[model samples]
Target: MDPASHPEQLSVVNEQVLNSADRSVTAAVCLRRFLCYGSESSTYSTKECPLGIENALSLMQLIEGGRGSEVVDEVRRFNLEGRAVRPNPGLFTLAVCSQHADCKTRQAALRALKELCRSPVQLFTFVQYKKELKEGSGMWGRALRRVVTDWYNGQDGISLAQAVTKCKHRAGWSHQDLLRLSHMKPANDNIALVCKYITKGWKGVEEAYAEKDKSEDLQKVFAYLEAVEKAKHSTDEQELIHLIEEQRLGKEQLLTNHLKSKEVWKALLKEMPVAVLLKHLGKLTANKVLIPGSPDIAAVCGRIQDETVLKKAKTQPFNILAASENYKRGHGKRSKLKWEPDRDLVQALDCAFCKSISTVEATGKRFLVAVDISSSLSSLCRGSSISTVAVAAAVCMIIAQTEPNAQIVVFSEGNLLPCTVSSDMTLMQVAGLLIQTPGGSTDCSLPITWASENEKTVDVFIILTNNQTNGRENPADTLKMYRQKSSVFSKLIVCGLIANNLSIADPEDCGMLDICGFDSQAVDVIHNFALDIF
Candidate 1:
């Protein structure tokens, strides 16, 4: 039998060797939990026993001595979770592979490395770690060689060169293994030239071209490089004019392709004519390239008076949420600029809800927005800079602006209190109030129970949470109880702020709806349910 197939055998062997030591028992339990938790038979029926990245890392660290296969099994479980449901676990995987000597463990580590390096930011991080490896170290050298070999064979030359460049500039170390691997794949001329320039100099490029008898094309390549250099140095006005001319040449291709530098983008926004800039602002906001609190952002906001522009800007909140989440995952970094809410952007988020409401006739339905301020929500919402509570607050603001009859409440640990949400409240004020509220254990049922006790009637109840409720009462059960006591039939909409396979909504109930994350379409989903049009 495969050693990996029987974790119990490994545990028994470990217990005997450790002579029933406390550490050994702990290690065995962690390993058993990891294996069972990742198995298909495990349903995660209880919230307390969920398998997470921390559990996988703890298990790998606890095991000791010649149990290479068992360690590999745990690492395999981690790899599967990261690929399927969990957020990025690259750092933990890297830590394990760096410390362990097992060949199987190293192989699993290589696979995780490949997955992690798919993001440019993560690739930069790996390159920094690679720089610290001692010259000719057996473990890391072998692993780094395998990574480069895979990149070469897979024909991912651009990514390979990008990794090498970022490593050299940021880490301040020359990667000889990557240089050698580049020569192994000489058919990729672009990668070859980039490697040659970095490892040697322009002289290396001449020699490389002479050897391949392609010296005639060298001038064109040099000209392109010179153009890029010039573009980098050009003033904002000159860059804007050049971009406009280029757009004419390419029949209005995305402006993002030309303005690659963040500084240049900011400069163009400040200096470009309002009419000229408005044409491209829609795509810029959609791509989320605009930096928050930049002067250019304010300028763009001031000039966006067109209804079409406002409609396009309506999706900015969703884009910001996505970008912020990516930043938290180590895939990107946040700007140093202080985050101040732009009035125009806030209006745009409100417009998104208005647009969704306009799709159906205005029913003047009353909305009750309940935000979960439980202690669990204080954690970063999937590596994002914003907390789960902050997102919940933003959603409440949207409802307040769209529905005149909307009321807001904050709940935690079976306690519910009215929030001071009003149409005149600024976005920053709303966020501050919600984030400052004290939190305890999660009680998703508190809001519904509170509403039922107060004899309140609302057409829709919107609950924002991560859905890891540890309340004395389940939300669905509470909703059922509320319906029995109250004559009004209110729809319960749970907006999950985290991505997970588990759902709180009953599949058989049409009145209960579950939506995940800060998706742009969430406004429409809530609106459709309110209208009973779904």
Candidate 2:
């Protein structure tokens, strides 16, 4: 009798594997949840993924025992350089691994603090996580003091002033509280003025420093800061627009009322990042900032198509696709805002979606892309209207478009049917067709078994699913038998549509990959894995 065939036996075996797994395996499993689902809201008591958080802290301790900084390095890389949809989850894990838990010294934590906290928002999230975890226990410890102090001293004067003005307080802690608790002595006069502004506002800057206290040339650094202070109180729309254009104030620095001005948005559009521009297309169009044949239309369309800007912002295909889907509806998904989307702008977004997708060099490998039509996959992805089946369809379309020898199919209990696809269909249309697929239980092994029975030559099998298979045949064994029958080694790639711990990929199979979330990064991974890039 095979113990792996029994649920109780398999559960015990899986537990043993998890317990004995090395730091690398443990870290991957723990970080998978964060990389997919973001951190839980502070309004709630329980975490978004408590098990993942527990495993993360445990992994940190395991790595710290070996005097390694692998977890820290991974978090830093994901937050700073990777095309992550959200950075706060990484920041939360980094805070857990860094400040709350430590090794002999605070080197890893300090390094992450200095490197990852690139902006005040990131710093606030990091500090908020720390506060939520410890609740002021050792919040004033020497190690934390050093971490906070070094973070402030690391930035230049002008940049630091702008950072301070971005966010006043978050997660029940203000910069004033941090500075006071850390006892951070400013590095210089400019730093001193910035610190004063954080603690006491512009009046504090005036009270602390006289006109002649600074060196003649050094006082100019605060010119932008002075403008920001004045802009906060100015009700004149023209004056606010002038300040934004002249000083290059970020959207975050603008007041609530100021955002209603079309001219202000136009001014901010000149410097808006691609990701931000994609998000506010509805508002921009409704406010008449982006219209048919307007200069702003050309600018917005050009920025969306700018390869360098998209790459720099790490823009994801799903973002552009989602924006297009929402924009084409002529109304906001969650708000009452409405606009007539420009045909040119919509075309630019669709073009950008394809261009933003990560690609790999085709290796002429035959591919079978199977999408699960299970009832669970019909449910919407968290925080988005894109259903899991929609994600599967988008991924299927991607493979068919990129690979020369790729077949697309939808699978349901013991059934595998070829899906009709056209080259001219938009991503949204493909998604709609897939979502309308009759929801049923999934037999994940159907694709492998059908291919084996038909003697179809397949090099890579890409399955997009929620992994909630209710079929009798085991996927791993089915793959093994198919490989034996076909006399050809084949690989399987499972793209998980939701954040869960389930995986159908065999642990020992080097050719199989279980990736969470169907994003551009996952597409890159699928392509590389198909080519055996590892």
Candidate 3:
């Protein structure tokens, strides 16, 4: 394979090799992006959207190659331990991986079924995916039966009641349908009664309660289920409020019309989790419960300010950013609902994002943060109102604020635009400035070329972009040229702002990394990568 011996043939062979390597890198990047953010569509948003799951699964299989089992194991552990935001992607990936991986990995992946299927909807999705692959009613294997049985019987009576009540049906499969298919005999009287409710509704559960000699635990479960049934049918707000307070029912158990009641919202605010509160701030405001000087607003702000609650909920910074942006806009992203956003509530959301950032010690290395402001990045991120350019700006600011010795520059095709990023500049201010900056075609190599020409001694160069580079000089080769000129072994991190498969980092270089743009742990990850801590 010593191509140098034949100079004429070496040119073609080298080009072919480069093309093959680029294809492999693109596949790997696509697989990673699909796992993190579902779908191969270019719509990159900050919301937890579950779009094109089946399509994403097919793409993963085509690109996964030999690493299917490893990726599945990692995703399973992360989702099972509640480290990931939305568990549906992980669950779907595990199902797909089990079908394609080796026998042992298949067993290991399937063992996580009960833990991963926390809700009835998730269980239905999982079952649907598994069944779709094999077209037969007789495809229910022993392992499938065991897992389904364990999923129903493993939860405590109260948790099971909440699960059945909150999600009656999903993915064209009902709890009754699943119960019938599994033929699962209940392990306890309480579980048995919940199953009865799932199969025959409140009538069946009440019938059992009237006839059976049940335990106090079963009686309590019966009471909770009865409250859920009443809450579903009741039009009286006061009675609904009483039931919510007494039984600790979530907003899901209530009827849709009752959600408009300000008193009901006030009651729900008392115990709403930080995640749910952020998601529904618009609805709360539209109902006038979050008006100025309202106690409901105070309660919500207090919860948002609680760092403990934020951490426990594992709320991502992007979620807060999207909430603030959408709330300030005073309209739903995909709904007709409109409201006047409360100034105090918006401030609290912004502050919550700042406080929620994970603190990490700076590596004290010289850094160059290059952000791409191309026109392609102007699209609104998939599930949020914020633009991809703004998301990039917010992420860049996070890094610039953390590291003391960092300089930022904006780049397009032939320009290295002026960047006024400062430690004191608010994220929104920086975003507005960057978005206003005139953009041209994307050129990812501008950072490296600029650093070399300016004689900047940078230990790390971070490029935030949509990965659509059109420069003549390859960024990888430019990095090598920069290393030769400055005699500094600079590392490159390509943080993709949108869900594109292209990457600028060299796959062969150990000093380069390709990561998602708005990863909640972006700052810590970048710092560690710079310090060689990974």
Ranking by lDDT: 3, 2, 1
lDDT of each: 0.53, 0.68, 0.71
Query: For candidate 1, lDDT tens digit of each residue in 30-137?
Result: 343334323122112212233344456444554345564455444454444322122223333354555566776556656756654554344444555544433345
Give the winner by lDDT: 3
Between which residue pairs do clashes occur in model 2? none
lDDT of 2 by residue, 1-534 (tens): 364554432331123222311111233443433433342110111124432455355445545565335555545544554423356666766666665344622477567768767876777777777777786576667777787888888877888877777777776777898899899988777777788888877787777665646764347556777789878888998888888888888888978888888888998999887878888998888888887999889988988998888878867676787787778778888799999988998899888877765432456899998887765566665435666766776777667776788888877776677876666777767776666455667778889888988889899998777765667887777887877778677887766666444467665454566665555445545654566433
Question: Predictions ranked by TM-score, top down?
Answer: 3, 2, 1
For model 2, the stretches where C-alpha displacement exceeds 4 angstroms are: 1-53, 57-105, 213-217, 358-367, 373-380, 387-390, 400-407, 412-441, 453-460, 465-467, 480-534
Tens-digit lDDT string for candidate 3 (1-534)? 354664432332222223422223233334434444453332223445554446574446542555555555446544543334445666777666566546755675677665566778888888777776565545467667777788999989999998988888887888888888888889998899899888888897777687878788988898899899888889888998999899988898887788879999888777787878898999888878888997778878988978888888877666788778888889997899999988889889888877665433457888898878766668665334677776777766766776777888887778886576876667777877677555677788899998888889999998877666788888877887887788777888777666434466665554676664454444444654577432
Q: Is candidate 1 or candidate 2 better by lDDT?
A: 2
Tell me how candidate 2 scores on lDDT: 0.68
The candidate scoring highest on TM-score is 3
Task: Go through the candidates in order and give the C-alpha RMSD of each one to the true structure.
Answer: 13.2, 7.7, 7.8
- Supply candidate 3's per-residue lDDT for 27: 37
- Per-residue lDDT, model 3, residue 162, is 87
